[model samples]
Target: MCFGYWLETRGHQVTIATHENFASFVRQFDLKFAPIAGNMEEFLQSKQGQRLIAGEKLKKEEGDKLLLQQLESAWSACQGSEVIIYTPLATFGYHIAEKLGVSCFFASVLPLTPQGCLGF
Candidate 1:
């Protein structure tokens, strides 16, 4: 929403990649949203994610596969973006975006912390 507001204030063409429902939220603003494919809710809680993190009886992978999935999803959406700006959790996503030949810019919703907020 802030991004849309900023773009409107600056009179720049802005296309926002967001959930379809959010279209109403930014209705008054001149921004376009590219909805992510599939059921957004289910995508966030997929079994692949649980397996990647080693849920209950599962074993964890050498690397985080859940994060990788996120990357794939976000990167796919980045195709329509001149530049992609994502939260820190999007490092994996940014990697995929770069692989897809799009510009990626990392943004954070929180301040730097010692609790390991860095993304590899």
Candidate 2:
């Protein structure tokens, strides 16, 4: 949001594609927002989702690749945008944008990784 606000203040139009929760938050700031696939909150509440995020579960089949599906949906949602500024969890945006010839950038807002805890 800080980044989007900064860009918006500088006269750049910014659109955020994320979960409905995040989209709603961004909308409160008067910035453009688009909903991405998968209910983040609902998924996070699931045991499988919690295990997957904690790395306690390994992908065994197509059904286990929820992360990939989420990213793919995000990629699809990014179409027509000038650039895609994505969070770490959506790293696939960078690759997808590259393939589509769209600009891509990364921004980390939450320090959810252990490496972030180390002050890196």
Which candidate leads in lDDT? 2
lDDT of 2 by residue, 48-104 (tens): 678877978655773357666677767767878788887876778888789889888
TM-score, per-candidate, Cα-based: 0.50, 0.75
RMSD of each: 7.5, 5.2
User: Over the stretch 1-120, how does candidate 1's per-residue lDDT look in tens digits?
Assistant: 565567656776666655455566656565666654344355446775466346454445623464455445555567656666776544555665667677777776566665342332
lDDT value for model 1: 0.57
Q: Candidate 1: where is the Cα deviation over 4 Å?
A: 38-76, 88-92, 109-120
The runs of at least 3 residues in candidate 2 whose Cα sits more than 4 Å from the true structure, single-residue gaps closed, are: 60-69, 111-120
Candidate 2 TM-score, C-alpha based: 0.75
- Give the lDDT of residue 93 in candidate 1: 50
